[model samples]
Target: MAKRQPKLVLAPAQGIPFNLLVLSQSNVRRVKNGVTIDDLAVDIERRGLLQGLSVRPLLDAGGQDTGTFHVPAGGRRFRALEILVKRNRLAPDAVIPCVVKPADGDVSAEEDSYAENAFREPLHPLDEFRGMQQLVDQGGKIEDVAARFHVTPAVVRQRLKLACVSPVLHEIYAADGMTLEQLMAFTVSDDHARQEQVWELIQSHHNQSAHFIRARLNESTVPARDPRALFVGIDTYVAGGGCVVRDLFEEDRGGWLQDAALLDRLVLEKLGAEADRIRAEGWKWVEAAIDLPYGYHHGLRPIEATHTPPTEAKLAEVATLQAEAEALENEWSGADEIPDEIDARVNALDERIAELAGGSWNYDPAEMAMAGVFVTIERNGELSVDPGWVRAEDEPVVESEPHGEGEGAQREDGVDGDHRQPGLAPESGEDEVQTEEEDEGIKPLPDRLISELTAERTLALQDAIAGNPQVAFAAVLHNLVLATFYYGRAESCLMVTLTKVGFGFQPSGMKDSPAAVAIEARHAMWKERLPESDRDLWDALQMLDANEQAELFAHCAAYSVNALYEVAPKYDNGRISAHTVERRLVHSHVLARAVGLDMVASGWKPTADNFFGKVTKARIIAAVTEGKGGETAALIDHLKKPDMAREAERLMDGAGWLPEPLRTPELPAQADLLEAPATSELPAFLAEPDVSGDEEPMAIAAE
Candidate 1:
């Protein structure tokens, strides 16, 4: 195997003489006279130099030893050392051990030197661009130059492009510290002038933040150049690069352009559907109008006809005949009864009178005149006439005319008086008028009842009950009792109102009996069916006082109790078993303690006849006994003196004064001597053999 080459070493700073290191490359040509050794010195002092020179031994043609080495890199560092030395600074003598690679094949030293100068400190873009230009000028392919610095050719082009960009844009780009990527995105145009314009745009906005730059770019009004113009054969603008077109479309369609094409299409489809709906609705209205009854197409129109006046002979004959009929009707109206002579004349003239009248003489003018005269008629059916009648001094006499019996000879003129009689029958229009009048007279009862119930009387009652809670409670009780007993339809409405009032205010009465009753009534009404137990409970409720009833039926309600308890009391009047009452009292006591009400005095007093008395006596007995056999002895010990005992004895004596059956004796002594004896087994009682059996066998045969 080949041995590994020795690794290159670097010089250390400590314990080394400072005057021996070579400072510069004698062979390398200088490009600028302004470049000085002091520049290198300043750089070194500011940032302590981290890298050393790479150099090789220099030889003359004679192959003799020469003291100089050709610098492969670090020319700047060597110059910096020279400056320090001239300024009386001690220089290190350490040989910065280097790999003597062939200089012709290696470009890393140049690239690294440039990179250190460009990046180790911030270099202005102009300076970097100049550096890149020099590198490309020095027989370096742009790619190779770019690759050596670990940058893309595009990036390198941007730096060079920066040289051509407007100074304004360059300053702007530099001020904002924009990335090359951002600048490339902005520089689509190859024209230096256009690129300069864009640069000016970019620079003018340097004072703007990144967000503002993006907004301006988004807002730029310049129309997008044809994609083919921008890039050969390109058919479309590059993604996300189009200028917003604010005025490209009509205002109504402007919003459509803002959305994605697909969304816009969907919106347009919806708009089309809506338009179709509107058109359909419009057409429906048109169709309906066309089909409507009493519409223009179906409406009535006025009729036009020529008029002719009646002949003068006919008018004179009608006037003469009307006057004759009026004279005859006046004569008939004045008569108490139509006289036989006048009746015959009136009947004969009736046909002629009807013909003279336009259509009918069946319409008696006398009847119409009588209707007017009867305006003063009293509702009691008494006819009245105007007293200021003008009486004729001499009445015109009506001539009697004989009737011609032959119908054909009445007139050759086609005249029928009977047709006129039909019009005189009282008009059917009066029937319709009377019907409308009747409907106007009647109203619905429920509406009236509701109105009456809500009147001031009801309101005042409600207010009074509300102000005096006791009245509200009594009202609730009253309503519940009514509901339970009647089971009427209105019971529910009444109970509901009472319950609302009951709950609205606290009961000021002894108990919430009314509230309980209302609750029970509601429950009974709402339940599937009334249970017998509920009926019994109702009966039990009535015997109880308000407090007892309230307490007993509070869960179910006293309405049921009141209904039943009014008839029966013993079982339903909240008279629970002593044990149950005791349990309830104990529970109440426990609850009171738990809720911090234990210290409150119960204010309970007991008498022998009452439930409380029994409970109290039982409690006292239990306490005194306490599983001890000295309860009486305890009581005796508790009464300290003989006189006090005598007083107690007297009270006991008085209690004993009642009938023997009614009196209760003192409790038995603790140590009374009435021990029960142990039961003994008597030899099974043997019955003596009956002599009647003559001699029963006394022993069994041996078996």
Candidate 2:
């Protein structure tokens, strides 16, 4: 093996004077790439030639060696040295390092040049980022590093940020396990724990999109474009000790606010100040909130106000705008599509006219004193002041009762049917005094006893109504009408009342509730079938036969039920008393049974995120005990709350269990009401079946 290796002759190396070296036409490199020769020349002049140029003996036609050398490889270096000589920086006779090769060497000058240019690998981006970061960490200024590398300061800073990614992610990036974009996403958060958590969550998933990673990292943050953030300018936010996180790798729309709680506090503080300022305008009350739920003015009356007339100058300006708009419209009338400038002008004129016309409204002083204003923020981050909203209870009370003759009969309690009163005046003499014992031996029942009796009566009435579904259905319809047309009053046979269900504060996942989904679907279905006009509804209902009516009645009756548990009234002004809520729920259970509601059967199941994850460990265990078995609950009791909740959720799956509110109260079985009950017993209107009689079975099943 040793004998087989041929003797290797290395390329010759020697020093050559700058004057003797000459550029070679055989050099392979022609196109510009990487660093330019001019930049190389500056570098060589500053530091002298770093790499030796490749030179060959300049041979004449007779093959005799010439004293001058022809440079091949590193021609750029030769040119750089030549420029220095031309600038008189380098002496013409200055010694230059050169690698000499025989003119007839085995390796051609072109091959040597090509090898030098194409063999070296460029540095990886991650390596460059890390190198930059190291320089920054070692005390090099970002500006200094950028100047040294011929890059923008922003680019240097971005590279430094990428270097600040979670070390675990950096390792992955270095190993080519993650993309550069994903690594950039991790730079959004400096917290290594959160970065690793988000990475761990999405790493195995196919959807490791950079945007998804950024979104997950910034889930709890407020986008810079959010109305709240816009209202509180970024400068003010930062001045108030808030931070913003930016994505240097992609467009982030000015980035995201890192401190959501601080932003909220600032928003509330500003809104409160604005509210106070508005309150100083002599309004009775000013309700301020970031957002008011849709239909917030329910059960309140909005008084119409007279608009203030515009000033003469403003009127003239409006007239001018109108004239301009008219001219533009006339000029572009025949065009299929209006020009953007003309359209913009028309829109601007319309807005100006509206602003001029929508002057401040004037309300009567008396009405303003009793009315309140809603100080709110609009979607566009502008302040909105809605005035002249009067609650029903706030309206002045009018005397409606007739006066009686005697002093005692005059209702000295200050109002008729009023129970709360001051202690009866102490009589002056024994003859006039009527003590408790001196009065008849009768006393009113205790309030608690009255409540209990009414509770029982409510239960009995619900049971009775359940037996007669026809009356129950009609009562529900009557209640709905009373609620719609006569707010705060009822003339229905049923005492139940359904408050307007406001979209007030929503729980996190309420929109995903199966009950909400079913309700929405049903609403859409009925909306499509209902007549367009209110006047057409009576005829439409008449067209539906008995079976359809019964089905429709059952559906409509569902809305009137008030089974929700509410806070008891601390003050007696509210309609529902503490005991009333309790009794109402108890009666609701009976109604629920009559309707045969089974929430579990209605496509609801316990899940860790939606239900179990939110509750306490004890609640989760209790749910597992109820839905699964006590054994299952015991198995998970030793686990942490989150883990126990998840396990309990899994164990409770497919088990027909429900919370008290959603469960249909179990009732004793009876013969099928549809088959046994006589048709005559049903409502006169519902006695006859539909033409197809298809929905009759549905009505029975619904009951």
Best by lDDT: 2
The C-alpha lDDT values of all candidates are 0.41, 0.74
State how far residue 93 of model 2 sits from its true place (Å). 8.2
Candidate 2, residue 637: the lDDT equals 79
Shift of residue 328 alpha carbon in model 1, Å: 99
Q: What stretches of model 2 exceed 4 Å from their correct place? A: 1-50, 76-97, 104-111, 131-154, 166-172, 175-178, 196-216, 293-295, 309-313, 320-352, 378-385, 401-482, 489-703
> Which portions of model 1 show Cα errors greater than 4 Å?
1-123, 130-150, 160-164, 172-207, 221-233, 236-703
lDDT of 1 at 107: 53
TM-score of each: 0.17, 0.59
Global fold similarity of model 1 (TM-score)? 0.17
**lDDT accuracy of residue 94 in candidate 1:** 39
lDDT of 2 by residue, 467-500 (tens): 9976576566545544543354544546667666
* Tens digit per residue, CA lDDT, model 1, 90-136: 34463344445343434544554465445556677667876887777
Scored by TM-score, the top model is 2
